[model samples]
Target: MLPPLKALPVFEAVARLNSFSRAATELNVSQSAISHQIRVLEDYLGESLFQRQGRYLALTQEGKNYLDVVSSSLSHIARASNQIRGEEDTKIRIAVYSSFAVCWLMPRLSDLQHKHPNLDITITMTHGSPELSDKTADCFITTDTEKRGFEYQLLYKETLFPVCSHAFYEQIKNTLNVTSDELSKRLKDEPELLENFPLITSNGIYNEYTEDWRSWFLERGIPLSNNIKFHKFSHLILAYEAAKYSLGIALVNDYMFSDKDTHSALVRLPSHRIYTNDHFFFSYKTSRRNETAIKALKQWILNEASSLNTLA
Candidate 1:
């Protein structure tokens, strides 16, 4: 009860491009071949799909509906096939936040590779949360949030603090004519001194626990003033970078600055830290928990997390 699967691809290409000639070129087929395939599909369906207007073509109402279904189905099939192929080759696909990918995960990736040279890992950076039902990635590293039907392991709980470049810290120290210890004590006692400098924070409304400047100040019972200068960035990584370049002081998490390289660039303010309820978690489908590659990755990630916990 199916039309030719071969013709379906040709029909979809023509419907998407709105031109048989262009679809033929894209598919590396002759225009006549494309026309024949479309005609065959239309005959099988017993309905015209496209409305012809001189040299141009447009989808009919029925064509639009069919195209939607066909496109989604084709894409799902392709993804499923690729996932199976990847699994056979011992590949692990990880979906993680863009900021974590750049700041935390990428820096530590060489360790993973050194430990498991045969394991092929693919990283997909996303701004939004991962969809576990989609089976898009074998694993996802994300902030703690309520979800059901997936196996998850805690990576680390993050602590927030105000951070700036060493140059900026020296500038503040010199301006106050205080030693490093004195500067720390003074900043702790007079937290309001932070308002004198340019502040950097995320423009995204992630969550209350995201540790933006407003939340950081509110946690300390010091109300942030509306008149204070701020440089808002679309992503946390950008804010972190701006702070590193001494553009402004940024509210950042402990994990992002954990590495010696990052810590060398930035210094956390003394005695001003906020602990977040949200923790980083490594999640995977329950069905895949026992798969060899998944199991290996899970163990490795847990070991890394345990080491971080010990250090913390």
Candidate 2:
């Protein structure tokens, strides 16, 4: 029969520390208690595990061999127990793209919590693609449609639109008197609207296919300017906040505007619309697809997507 795990920990601690009193100090137990536990453990094993030296205890040959196996087994048990407890406690680790987290997921997260009250979801931000090999997170929220090594479900697709704050409109609503092309050019020249205002950018998220202010203006048949100043952001939501506060106009994707209140504060600029293939997707390691918690979340996300599509 295997030895009790409780005894093995005390024995391992005493063996590593090489002094029962020191081990007791570390474990917050009396030296006599530590010595008694070790004695019980050695008796149970039917071996003298320690040899008396000048003023200390040394591991016997049997003790050395047993220590090698027992130490490893005990450490493994501790880690596994912690993991099981975490799962039982309904703790979940999730990795989300910063842009999606701020603009879309965060506002809707309470819905998930309300349904799964026991679930504790902790999120970490990924700059672009998350490292799948790390397993730091059990799930990831991404925009890529490509098939990964994990089970995946599409959350939502997004389209692009021009949005500006109420303050921005109040300042440039007079420019609306000109032709759409002329208005874009004139508005592009406003220091508050164009020069001083920060343009939220997706530097890493869409570096290969960056959405540029000049492209947005040129789409309206206006000449791209050389004097215009622009700024970029790693996450799109940061840009949304800047735009919401009248920092400047942002070519926000539709999914980012999750709130009716935020939507009402901004007006879509004239003749401005763009299409992109970006969409939110949830993914998990393929081996974990059958896990109870993963299956639960998967079903909920799919049901939500289906309902959203039906409404659309």
Candidate 3:
């Protein structure tokens, strides 16, 4: 009762390209083969779909109408076929903050891959909170702001502090001709010590609660003057990288600075830890909580977090 499905693709290719020869070249068939299929399709519909002007081709009104339906149908078929073959099942999509992905999750991904060799994991990074309603990702690692329809598991809370490269710290100590303890004491007691250095801060957009430089300084009772030299970065990850290379001091959360390689390169300033109320959480749709891939990824993340806690 239906037109031949095989001829539709050939006809679509010819109609879209406006050249039977070009369509044959694209589809890896002969020009005569393309013409034959188009004729077969035209016979089935009882209509002339193309107007031939010597070597050129143009779609008739009916051709245009049929193309709209045929293209949409083919796309739907391809999607459904891929879905039926389990192409979508093997992937675990995770949404997370850009800074957390760069500084924390990326480093630990190798361990995850080693454990689950066949699993395909995809990462989507965001600066602010991602939309839960879009169904873009299977799970999210985000700050503990509640989403109404999602279930959350608390990962850990973070402590904020100033971090800088060892080279920069040594430069300050040598320049002041003081011991490490004295250098730390001076940093805490003398606001001028902080004022003398180039301070790095995140751009005041995205998540304002966690990334505000002015709030961090004000919380420690230190005044932030407009005249002080400051370097601003779009994301905390960029600021962290800059701090690692001795460019400037960056205010970072504990989790971002926890990697052994990162810790070796940087030192947290003394007497300046601020424990935040914002905890990190792993969240997913309550309805999809039982999905096998989602469950596996969730348990892996929890295990990784547990190891970090043990090491801490």
Model 2 per-residue lDDT tens digits across residues 191-273:
23343344545544345323555555555666645555555665567677777788777777655653345446676554445
RMSD of 3: 8.8
lDDT digits (tens) for residues 118-179 of candidate 1:
88889898887776543357789877456675788998877667889989988878878899
lDDT of 1 at 134: 31
Determine which window of 10 residues in candidate 2 has minimal summed lDDT.
Answer: 190-199
Give a tens-digit lDDT track for model 3, residues 63-125: 988886686466446546766787655577899888778877998899989998777999999
- Model 1 has a clash total of 0
Ranking by TM-score: 1, 3, 2
| Ranking of all predicted structures according to lDDT, beginning with the best and ending with the worst | 1, 3, 2
> Which residue ranges in model 2 land beyond 4 Å of their true spot?
1-89, 144-148, 178-202, 208-211, 214-223, 227-234, 259-265, 303-312
Clash list (residue pairs), candidate 3: none
lDDT of 3: 0.76
Name the candidate that leads on lDDT.
Answer: 1
lDDT of 3 at 118: 75
Residue 270 C-alpha lDDT in model 1 = 79
> Alpha carbon lDDT of residue 287, candidate 3?
60
In model 1, the clashing pairs are none
lDDT of each: 0.78, 0.66, 0.76
lDDT over C-alpha atoms for residue 15 of model 3: 75
